[model samples]
Target: MKTLVNTLMMRVIEYFASKDMSQITHTLCVHEYTRLIALREGYKTRKVLLLELAALLHDIGCPRSKELYGNCLPVNQERIGAEIVSEWMPAYGKLAPKEIDWLVKVVGTHHQLPMAKEYGFEALFEADLIVNLMEGYYPKEKAALYEKNMVRTASGKALFELFFHHGKMDIKSD
Candidate 1:
């Protein structure tokens, strides 16, 4: 199951595999941060799996958007990337339809702020927060302004506070 998931996600990101090494590295860090935050928060294994998808494909549409729109805004990329992910993920046979529903939404709108206080969406949001904070793209995207706006589960909130207080993105210096 894990291999299947990785295979599907790799194919999705392969769309941008040649564009920028930084893009790939940035994504890997996001994924790692997602796992750390999820485990640190004590999220269920299944939920952590969903968050993994969110991080891996978070910027998957950037290359396509650069070709068509000359810009790779997070919102647009996530929208298109979700469309692509929809093609392969449903066949994986792990998550229920409802889980898939939340997973799809999480991937699609990961860039934008939460529109509702929903669990899946908040999970993706908080995970992205950790990534942005680590990547030093926090305040630039106005994400730093949201560090205090915690949501999601108790574990998630704790992890968010850890990152929030650290203020540094917890990434490597060199």
Candidate 2:
């Protein structure tokens, strides 16, 4: 199952693999972070699996959007990405129809929504925020603002504190 999951992740990334390695690396980190956060929160296995998959494919539409619009705007990417993931979900195998739809929604609205509050969506959002903060993709003030106002999960809140607030490396046990 793990191998199949990994293979599916790669296949999804292949849709528009960036020449720059940063995007791929960021996605991988978000996947790991999402899994870690989910595990820490004691999320069930299937939800963790879905959240990890969302983390991997959240930016899958960026390359496609660039191809079509000459720029990967978050709104465009979110819209197009929903279409892409909807098509790709069945290829991953064994996902129920509802699970596929739910994942498609997660990937589609990941950037546009203010907050979802669902376990998988919250995990994905926080994991992406961690990468965005560390990579300087988001300004510290803005990240802090979001952390204060938007972060909803206990695990996510703890991670934000660990990475951005406390500046510590004791993430795994937290």
CA deviation > 4 Å runs, candidate 2:
16-20, 113-115, 118-120, 167-174
Candidate 2, 1-174: lDDT as tens digits? 566569777875564364435578788888998888888888888888888878888888887787789987778988888898898788767788998888788887886435356524787888888888888888876767888877877788888887778765445553
Report how far residue 34 has shifted in candidate 1, in Å: 1.5
Per-residue lDDT of model 1, residues 51-116, tens digit only: 787677777767777777888787677777777667656877776787767666766777666542
Q: Per-residue lDDT for 21 in model 2? A: 50
User: TM-score of every model?
Assistant: 0.72, 0.87
Q: In model 1, what lDDT does residue 100 have? A: 69
Best by TM-score: 2
Candidate lDDT values, in order: 0.65, 0.78
Report the error of model 1 at residue 169, Å: 13
